[model samples]
Target: MSTPSRFKKDKEIIAEYESQVKEIRAQLVEQQKCLEQQTEMRVQLLQDLQDFFRKKSEIEMEYSRNLEKLAERFMAKTRSTKDHQQYKKDQNLLSPVNCWYLLLNQVRRESKDHATLSEIYLNNVIMRFMQISEDSTRMFKKSKEISFQLHEDLMKVLNELYTVMKTYHMYHAESISAESKLKEAEKQEEKQIGRSGDPVFHIRLEERHQRRSSVKKIEKMKEKRQAKYSENKLKSIKARNEYLLTLEATNASVFKYYIHDLSDLIDCCDLGYHASLNRALRTYLSAEYNLETSRHEGLDIIENAVDSLEPRSDKQRFMEMYPTAFCPPMKFEFQSHMGDEVCQVTAQQTVQAELMLRYQQLQSRLATLKIENEEVKKTTEATLQTIQDMVTIEDYDVSECFQHSRSTESVKSTVSETYLSKPSIAKRRANQQETEQFYFMKFREYLEGSNLITKLQAKHDLLQRTLGEGHRAEYMTTRPPNLPPKPQKHRKPRPRSQCSAKLFNGDLESFIKDSGQVIPLIVESCIRFINLYGLQHQGIFRVSGSQVEVNDIKNSFERGENPLADDQSNHDINSVAGVLKLYFRGLENPVFPKERFNDLISCIRIDNLYERALHIRKLLLTLPRSVLIVMRYLFAFLNHLSQYSDENMMDPYNLAICFGPTLMPVPDIQDQVSCQAHVNEIIKTIIIHHEAIFPDVKELDGPVYEKCMAGDDYCDSPYSEHGTLEEVDQDASTEPHTSEDV
Candidate 1:
């Protein structure tokens, strides 16, 4: 019982514990391998089920298609004398034929002889194929679900095994540390007392150490045993959980699959109940092509038999038997020729009556013209008399001056005419300056003759009398209580009044006349058209065929064609609108500059209407002379157009909306459409109150091109005026351009 023996015992116990732990690890490895194998087997089974389902579905689909083709081919065949061999050969397709026969019989039993055979066969085949496909899919899906459940169970078991392995390692490490401590204690005792029989004290110490060491070994073994037991329990629990999961998944799969199978079978039976009857009918019809021919032959034979009857009684009986088979005899009517003659006579008489009516109307119109001539003569005379009254012509006789003229010699004439050379400054100032002396003499004569002295004396006396008082009398006389005050006229000062009328003029016709420029005939026509129709319709009516109208206007003006051609059909509202749009756009500067549109809108919100109008005037003045001239006419034209009632009355607001986009610069039509309302408000404010808004502006008085050619300073605009307009005019004039070019 020395130190060496205790150390040896500790070593033996450590070895036993290590071996036990190793055995437990080996068992865990074997269980894991078994679980892995089972998982692989389940996965393979699921995969096999899927492949079987796919194959079955494909086979069923192919069989259904084949059955359909088989039925159609059999029905389409000509069973002629030469087709018996072919019919026999077609029997090789026994699968479809057998299916057809089974479906036919099933329909007969179920339908109680109410269904056709061929249709029933087809329906049954299709329904059976769909049912089988659905069943196989359901079975495969159930198997797959079971496999998934098993996999989850295995995963849980593996996780628990990992936990057990970790715990075992922890316990093993503790046991190893205990053994090492026991070994160290023994080693230290041996170093202190090496011989077994050294002393009783030494021996007692050694024996006590051995006993303590043995107790420690026993305790370590007990702890190892307990750890092993815990590991085993964990394994057992994992196995039990896995079994329970598997059992539940199996039960669920079985229940769902069977339930689905039963339902699908019932659905197939219920939905395909008429299949057999439909099949029988189709088969019967396929064999009945000669029935129609036989019916017609029977009708013909009956007709021949009826024709052989001689007695009237027999004929009546035959006709009654076949009421719809005979044709009724025709009866001729003799009135057809007389009816034709009457229709011709009526047509001729109507034509003669229309001619007579037209002749009488023309004669009446001629008589009206003669009466109109007499009225016109009276109107002319009255117009002349009115002119004479309004404007007077005076007669002046200059015969006396002409008669008094005398002849003179050149020297005498020169001396008489040069008499002013003898005059001095004093004499010139004092000697009766003709105008001053004459007026002065006349004033003295008038004062002396009209009792002026007496009136002066009386006025002096009255003033003295009035001044002698406290001035109450003077106040009474000077300030009369009963007199009314005169109203003074308030005049707003105009900034520029080069050429303007006294009144606020909206007459566009006067503007055209005052312009003194030859506007194209088409342009005038377009204006008329716009005023006539555009005011009524707003944006609805456009000047149709603008290109042609522009071309015609250009041609007529440039080529000296008749400006007042009677045919005005070439001009329309749209064409006029286009021309106006072009007039603005063709300027050296756009009237509504794109960058300034928003700024103009901001200016419109100014509280003072005059200031806002002034801002708008400044914006308009910034445009080229050509643009201003067109804009002036356009404003007047719109003013005239707006004078109407009800529906035809186009206000400034509608006019602005109609032309805002057409006149202004926009990125696109879509932006224009969106901004139209804003444009309408702004333009309406400017145009309706243009006289106030643009108080100092005036329309150009001549053709814009002529002004450009003359190098007028005012024609300059922000866009620059470098004779581009002059060049354009020259090009337009020289070339045979159409109105469209304008």
Candidate 2:
């Protein structure tokens, strides 16, 4: 016994197999469609992102431009008048104004970052997205085409299998028919032989011969039929074998398609598409992240500037700038009428009498104010109690009281009717309550007024007493002996310079000489610390340090102490940078002397790079030896800093913007405002071409130089001690005399 076939017929098997193939094809199509749809969506998403960033960048650019214009306009307006000079002198005002300027610059920087982000999205990110989408689409199409061809090939094989199966069935039916005919012919021949043996009918020799001939013909026919059956059977077996082989081949192809080929196609389409999308999205995210980081850095700079503003410092600066305006007025003297006879203004008796009288007046006023204050305090307490009682009345349960009244009304109907008839009574009660509340509020207001009056009286008394004491001190004291006025002697006034006690605001050359170094200790320490710790810190110089900390560090340097020698980990990088900036800003003569400001500006404006660099080198060589050496050291550090611009975001241009004014201050005049851009450009050019502008000198290198370069404690370098001062003086003598020299 054999197991029954699962399928009833070959047609059913073939139909089921074709159905599976169709399903697989449909699945492949669906997968391709899904991939295409995802690709389209990703492309659309990228496009939207691009548009968003572009518009955002436009907004940022416009906003930044407007802010820059606003700052420039205000700065111009301020610089056009004497107030600008006053602001420069007044440290308090200068700080906030500088902060405002810095704020505007930071915003402009952020806007530029946003604009850059927009450009990246449009030029780089979007282009990559488009390319990825194209590749994905192309891949999907190619996969789809391959899948369709594979399905077509499978269908052809299936069709051939069906044809083979049909031919096998035809041959099998012919063979069955031939075998039936042969069996029937053999049965007829048996029937004829039986009739001859039974003798049931007349048996002649001719009849027997006819019967034998019939039997012979039947046998011949049977033999021929048997031969045909055999032939049909062999053909049927051949057709069956062909059908089986075709079916097996088709099965293998289908199996391989479903297990390997289809999966590979799907993976190709899906994985590649997803991978490309992932990469594109990651790129966008990275760009966005960097943009936001830059924006935050800019904001931090603005915040630091705002935090460093000092109102007290500004006030002190105001006083310092306008000393005459803050001078004490002369003491008042008693003036007598021309016809009147009165004591001299310095008479002790008259002064004593006036002081006693003022003291009495203040004492009387103070007593009266005390009494009034007591009265107002009591009244205020009474008013507060009344208000509290009113609040309690408002919180009473009127509904419960009404129910009790109704219950009593039923018991005393005649009394209730009489009470209801007198509605004016209830109205009178409500009016009384309102009157009491009004009185309470009025009492509170009166108490407040009385308290205010008492306070004013007390203050008046205090002021009167103070004035009396001041007058007594002024007039009751013995006057100094009057002497004849000395004859006026005209003498030349001495020119003002920085105070000798502090390190800052002094001559840079003097400081260099004192320190016995080519670079000041403060500058060298700051640069070294920044290089060591701040290479990756964003917005190093742009962000301000704590004013208190900066001042502390500055004081340390001024006091001949190395503040940075202590644990550097606790030192803020911005604070060090701030100290450095302050050192430059406080120089009596900027690193680039004021006389050569125009020359430096002109050098930067030259069109040809080689010519500009040549002129810059010449101008730099003309600087005092100390100034030139320091500039070289500073510019070298700045150049090195700019190399890490990607991390610190302090490129040469940004650094120049921060340091330009400090190194080459514009004269406090209206004409130099337009030259500020050139000044910044000059500084930028120097920073970029520092090697060319300030070539290394062999004589400058020493143990101190190495120490400075290595971020060690500052020591006297060889240039300072090796007869360099005479050369510096000679260089200075050649330049036109400026106010700084005085």
Candidate 3:
């Protein structure tokens, strides 16, 4: 009963449960009704996203607007500063931080108004931009240099294209003309048609006429095609011409012209004034920065220019215009002829009076000197005779005493100090025989050329006598019982005399070399000039131009330097040796010992001078790199010389340094200026030559051309290079090719 009844009941229950679930679900779904909460929550989330995006966009827009405003204001500042008074003073760009504090204190005491500050936006931008501006300008310097080269290349490319296109058009025209003639040679003909490897049919008379007509139509069609080609080519040519014009305009506008007027209050002034003003303005701006100051002036300038500018119609023409209305012309008046004449007359009178008095005094002094010199010669001869007689008697006595003195401690050797021992077998074998010839050649050079020498005898005579056999006796005869012995000369023999001498002498000749085996006369002159200028101990003075005076050198040496330290003596030795070699082309002879100079002066050999110079040239040509190293010596020498009473400094008047395959030997005795002009002319020619031929090393072309650009400042000229010419220029009169102004 349970199983049957449960089955029927379960079916009834399942059907009723299904119906109830559907009614429950339908009632539950229909009961939900409030939309406001869901709508409001979704709307809030969407509003938050929208508001975030809007704020971000507004911030970005504001930032961009501010940046543009800053750029415009900066441009305006640059433009205004172009004319300002403080544009170029260049001390500290920014004042010390404390400076503004001091300024504020003073301002506060003077008045109640507080220091004005720029707006936050403008001040902040300016501070950032100043750092950026300096960096940008420096970085752009390289770009600007590169731009110049680019512009030059562009011009070349454009020119080449124009030429190639012209040639192509001409060739095309000729080819078309030839083709037209060929068209006439091509014609149509009728022939018998027969079957051969194919089936063939002959046309009727009317058909043959049609074939001929077809050929005529083809000829006409070819002509039409040719005409069409010509029209298309014409269009291309027009387009190309328009393109060229557009290119020219674009090139013109690529650069900007910044016009800067002189400050309003300043009258006609020099470039120096402008540069000073620019530096000063930069300094003030760097110093006067304030966070809160208003940039109204800068804004106003930008706004005015923006409002005033009109859209350009002729861009090419506008860019071509230069910044012309800047500095004004200064007025000057020429001195009258009579006024100039009077000035010259006065100068002449003063000069003549001085010269006349000098001449008279000189004549009187010459006469007196002649008498004194004669007496001195006589006295010298008499003293020599007495010395010879005394030496003979002293030798006799010494010889007799030598037997006794050999056992004692007082043997005098006066003869050894003055005489050199004859060459012995040991001495001869010590060095190569070739060194003797070299030595003889060098010795002959000394005989020919006059160089200064420091006499060892003059330096050590007192030491020698006091320490020799006569010293104790002279002391015994003169000493007052208990006087202490004085300090004696201490000798320091060193590596300098041997090692430095070898190192320096090895490259001595080579440093003076020029482009080739044969040094030019101008180079020779320069070498001589350097020699005379550097060797102040020699009886030579660098007067002006390349001329020197012997007497001045004597006076300077006679007024010798203070007691020299050992290092100083070596320096003097090296200077003398190096300097002399520059002139005579032999180091040893130039820095000869005083004993050596004495031997030369006592003899004569003029022919040896030329030989030494030639030999030196050969020596130098053998080594190249050492030449530059030694030339630095010339720079050092120029630095050391003192100025003369009649001079500003002692150095070369001018020089043209050559770096390329040096051009040399313009025939004739043309002076330094003419030589300079000739070299400059050659450089210009090389620069203008096809770059395809020379390549980029042509900057080597610079020195020769720019030689004339070198000024007195670079050379340490001894006098004004103005209207005044050297008195030594007179020597050039005999030299026919030399200029009066030399």
For all predicted structures, in order, the TM-scores are: 0.23, 0.35, 0.19
lDDT of 1: 0.39
Q: Residue by residue across 437-536, what tens digits does model 2's lDDT show?
A: 4544444344334433433343333334435566545433422222111111111111123223224767878755554555667777787777667866
Number of the top-ranking candidate, with TM-score as the measure: 2
Q: Give the CA lDDT, 0 to 100, for residue 211 in model 3.
A: 62
lDDT of 3 by residue, 284-382 (tens): 232222211376466456444433322121111222332122212111111111111211111133233443343344334444554554555465445
- Note the Cα lDDT for every prediction shown: 0.39, 0.56, 0.30
Model 1 stretches astray by more than 4 angstroms: 1-525, 528-574, 582-588, 607-611, 624-626, 645-649, 667-676, 695-742
lDDT of 3 at 213: 76
Could you say which candidate leads in lDDT? 2
Better of 1 and 3 by lDDT: 1
Task: Count clashing residue pairs in model 2.
Answer: 1
Q: Which candidate would rank higher by TM-score, 1 or 3?
A: 1
